[model samples]
Target: MGFTTPTPIQEQAIPIILSKSDLIGCAQTGTGKTAAFLLPLLHLLTEANAGTEEENPKIKALVLVPTRELAGQIDQAMEGFSYFTPVSNLAIYGGGDGAGFEREKMALTRGSDVVVATPGKMLQHLRMGYVDFSQLQFLILDEADRMLDMGFVEDIRQIISHCPKERQTLFFSATMPPKIRELAKEILVEPEEINIAISKPSEKITQAAFSVPTGLKVELIKYLLSVKSVPNCIIFCSTKKSTKDLERELNSLDIKATAMHSDLEQVDREKALLQFKSGEYTVLVATDIMARGIDIKGVALVINFEVPRDAEDYVHRIGRTARADSRGVAFTLVAPDEQRDLFKIESLIEMEIQKVAIPPEIGDSPPFDEGNRRRGGGGRGGSRGRGHNGRGGGNRGGGGGRGGRSGSGRGRKPAGNRR
Candidate 1:
């Protein structure tokens, strides 16, 4: 592996992990948190398993994640990091055929050095009575908050019930909500805590939004893609229906785009993601499922066709771009009803995103008003603005004028040294 200076999370986390103590790590997406945990764990496993000649190698480490995509991503990264080493690993997730399940069963029974899995699939295997974790020494939960959000808390507990209680546990989450803290208390021992830029998007991302009417949001997206010629873009919608609808509209306009949602088969989802990553698809229209954990690099832009319901989700959605010291842009289209959601996001990010004026050809857009969100005002009555010239309007609504109030004042203090 090309070794260089570690990222902030890696620099702080790797040492703690190497100490063989439980740990709680809170960091934003794309901050090298995965490598932070993986590198140290791999080192320990390689050292422990050296010269071992047991007939049945028992599983030593387990990583539980929320999504299949993240499981596969971590599995690939594990392969690369352990390529020259003796460590063996496997990724277990649903949506595969019987042959895939049988392969996972073989690996689990024979004991891969490390096993990464989604909670449901892992629980399914655990119920079979053939999988054993008596020798497990490490238990890791990546995206703990996301798992809780997906209603996997009980499933996680069930999986943990099968593991050895004496094992070291690591909990990594992008956000440190109270629920996460509770879960951490139940799982991890006196673990060293590390929080790195929690709930903050990378500073390299150029953030802006267009206050378009709900009806004309698709037209504005078309204008941005066609006139501005944005390449490698990811447009996020709030629902699967919206994703499919927008994809259809973009395809109708001769734009090469694909849709990714939970309804699609796993193979189709993987193919769509591959096409997006390979530049065969110029744009990927997706729901919030693609917001976190799926790492596709070199994306030029992230567009939020609708505001996410949760403020923290906004951070993750924009985080798809501007990863790893690269510059990128994020845009949000705010409908009148979604103004409250926008205000919440601005409050969370601690800055009022610049409001780009809607193109006159796309018709007038509603004013940036959070108070009038309940009225559901349309674009017909708002003042006409100039075309897409990048001129931004003054701060409006509950954003507290320009830079919003600091989020530092709210939420519990991070349990460890803040970086």
Candidate 2:
């Protein structure tokens, strides 16, 4: 909302939080939820400064997110809002070398009024006595649902166990699950609920799913790329190997895409994100782990090369497209083995996506046909073609700016199939 007006989520949420009550906000991504909490948070902290009239500051606010990308995104947003004010902040996460993160943590310890962190890295620091939150006055669990889904409940519980009980707590998530609701009750103090009504995927996006034999997925993807005036899109895969393989195959077919996940170095992740945001690539191949944290704007399409294991994951993936009140599309390629998972996802979202017709020419070979395999099919060991693997590329502009059209990278790693 730089020069523009606030979104519905922001408008509804900002005022309620400004009253100093704890809140639970359930809204979709791209609804401006970030500003809803950030605005009130900054205002409250700045006002606290006037009352105390102090030159030094203690850690007053803590934001715990699920991923490094989100921590960075929130940190950047805080910096922008606190630009004119004296309230400074820092973002902390893992994936950086130990020494660099340690130095940054020390810098944060010295003066930052707010600290945003991921659970794993934050736990590492807390147990080693590198930082303390006993005096922490405010706590926020952004994307609380994702944290629980990522198996960080123990870490979150340990962190919150150390914070002052009297401190205010606010929990925000695109969607809330039963476990998150229980966790919210444990932490929040007389919380004022601010559940934003818009929790489902956008109606603007044309939702479609296709039940295809596993071998024909690549051919289907190729056919979709060839036919749909596909601008920039995201391809969701179940395995890192599939992600890397699909990316190499797409690039081989002149699709100009990139892969991102846990395996890439932090610096490379940052670079790949920047390039995608800058329109250096048209497609970003990734796994579901990266879904919630990827906040790119104006993504025209979301292609689930593999059906997600859970219904919630399906919502988040399609949420990447149809952002900022703009129109988008989502396609899912369901293999015969995944029919059950597909049914569960559709049931959770409470709507049936129409079946899409796949052209005959998409896959000419069997899905596991090693004979037709791209070079180095299984891992990142594949040669980096014309496109930059991580950092070695010049910025190339597409139709629009990166704000609404950025793509992302994901590392290769497999996760448990939905139970």
Candidate 3:
């Protein structure tokens, strides 16, 4: 990890965290926010243990991420940075085997220097009465906005209550919405606040949109990919069914593609991301779960199959490309009905996205009719991707509860999760 030059967030945040000051740093994803907090946290932990003879690996830092994928990501990053040092870490998340839970229990109860976890699963462990956080020194909430959207606010409050009151709390988010500020106010006392690259897409991203009929989306994707020399792409779909359907159809057209959504088991989900990262697939069809912190490099393009519900999410979806100062393109397929979403996005970013006409190959399309356009439920409904991990009878509906199993990320109903 020869990260010599730090991004803006890292430059400003690292020192503040090192000083043990509570902080709330706001920045978009892919802006080195992880290292901004982690590097200092690691340094503090390392310095604190410099002369200690006791080596029980007590958890000194707790990072609560919004998604299981992000939890795994932070755990991997910790290992990378602490490779030459004695920094033991564990990533606790839902949707794993019983053995996995046992391992998490062992690490949480026994010891680990750092613990990265998802909010819901972390609450589950805390409820079990085995884990100890009375000595927690640093608490981090990554992707705080997403957690709030997933109905994890109450769970987060509960988890925070269990920790020592006198602790350094750091909350990092892509966008600093009012709700996020509200939470920060409640939790952080005299926190040094910093906002970098707020509510804006990177300048390197070439943004454009296609206003087409919903029916023509698949055809447009087929024609565009066939015509353009796309090295790699991510097609963001609105639904898990559509993700799977598009992947299957793209494969039928002989394009190496895969669908990644809640329908996939934890194993398969990991495998899909691995295959994509390893260059086994040129395209990854997914939902907004991939929109945030699941890093995959050399992504030349991001195609929104349908407009996202939230304006800020559009920024995140496009942020996947145009990362690390490399130029890339973001194309959104906006249905006539989704004009409102597109308008919101343009308004949020304070720039009009270039409107591109669909190719003639994908012929006549539906015209935008305001009255006929149905209001799209674009954002997370209920527990977002907290579907049960069960393959069958034991299906834990997302958010960890007993319910009829539906093979989708935002699967069928199960009132709510324990968290």
Query: Judged by TM-score, which candidate is best?
Result: 1
Any runs in candidate 2 off by more than 4 Å, and if so which?
Answer: 3-5, 51-56, 197-199, 363-419
Per-model CA lDDT versus the true structure: 0.78, 0.70, 0.76
Candidate structures ordered by TM-score, highest first = 1, 3, 2
Write the residue-wise lDDT of candidate 3 on 1-419 in tens digits: 75779887887888877767777777778989988888897787777666443335556678999988999899888878776666667788878589878877876765676889999999999999988875677788999989999999999989987876667788788666678778877777667767674566788999888878888888889887887788889999878888888899899989899888987777788999999988899999999889999887789999999888777789889989987868899999988878878876776776778877787778765544444323432322222112112111111111211111111111111111101
Per-residue lDDT of model 2, residues 48-70, tens digit only: 55434333345677899998889
lDDT, candidate 1, 239-356, per-residue tens: 9999999999999999899999999978889999999998899999999889988888788899999998888889899999988868898999988778877776766665668988
**C-alpha TM-scores of all predictions:** 0.87, 0.82, 0.86
- Point out the higher-scoring one by TM-score: 2 or 3: 3
lDDT of 3 at 322: 80
Give the Cα RMSD of candidate 3: 11.7
Better of 1 and 3 by TM-score: 1
Which consecutive 10 residues in model 1 have the weakest lDDT in total?
399-408
